[model samples]
Target: MTDQPAVPTDDPTVLTDRDLEVLAEQLGREPRGVVGIAARCVCGRPLVVRTAPRLPDGTPFPTTYYLTHPGAVAAASRLEAQGVMREMTERLGEDEELAAAYRRAHEHYLARRAELGQVEEIDGISAGGMPTRVKCIHVLMGHALAAGSGVNPLGDEALALVRDQWRPDRCSC
Candidate 1:
């Protein structure tokens, strides 16, 4: 990994018209239930967005922090293709310290989402297979970017693993 620290997390910021445009471009579709820009690129572009617990279409969306940057998404996908998730999940089973930390991450995610609103359908659920397995690196990366380091051990690990491919300290957008 580079000596530079990963991009620091930012508090949720009010969404602007330009932010919506950028998000749409990054996602290749209209973003749904976005409440605020949770993390940004070095150049001030949106990298992660905070979504509402319940969407307008009546869907109980569980993914609170959504990764929008195309470069970061691709990097996470590459890690998944390389079976990083499976490896991490295995490590979680063998590492008690890591498993406990991951459980805390799951609680953190739930507490944060509770502030938005309650959605019974996904009540105890956090993204990226938290507290159990590594299902989606993209979700973990997004959580790391939005929640900052140390909150999500596995998320932080995934972020570090993909540093060579994508780093929030630099803008690829």
Candidate 2:
């Protein structure tokens, strides 16, 4: 992994017009409930988006941090196809320390989401299949990028694997 720039967690609270346009281009649809930017690429492109707990239609959305960068998403998909999530989940079961840390990550995610707003439907649930299994690398990496390093072990691992393809140090914008 390369020496990447630190992802400042203190991001913009609201998405700008350009942010929305770029996000739409990246996602292939209009982004819904995007409350803030959780992380960005070195070129200042939006990488991770923090969503609202509930949508305008009153649907409870659980995924707080959404990964948007195409390169990073593609890389994470490659790892997922390689069964990285399964292996990481197995590792979580074997390593108590890692599991504990992951649980904390889950807690941190919940707390952060709580700061935005609380939807009782998703009170303690954290996104990206946290605290139990390694489900989605996109979720994990988004959480890692948004929360910074040393927060999500599996996320960190996924990020390390994708560094060659998409590192936060260099902007692909």
Relative to the true structure, how large is the alpha-carbon lDDT of every model?
0.88, 0.86
RMSD of 1: 2.3
Question: How many residue pairs clash in all the candidates, one count each?
Answer: 0, 0
Candidate 2 residue pairs in backbone clash: none
lDDT of 1 by residue, 16-36 (tens): 889999999999999999998
Runs of candidate 1 with Cα error greater than 4 angstroms are 1-13
**What would the per-residue lDDT of candidate 2 be over residues 70-126, giving only the tens digit for each residue?**
988998999999999899899889999999999999998998898889999998889
Model 2 clash tally? 0
Estimate the lDDT of model 2.
0.86
Return the top candidate by lDDT: 1
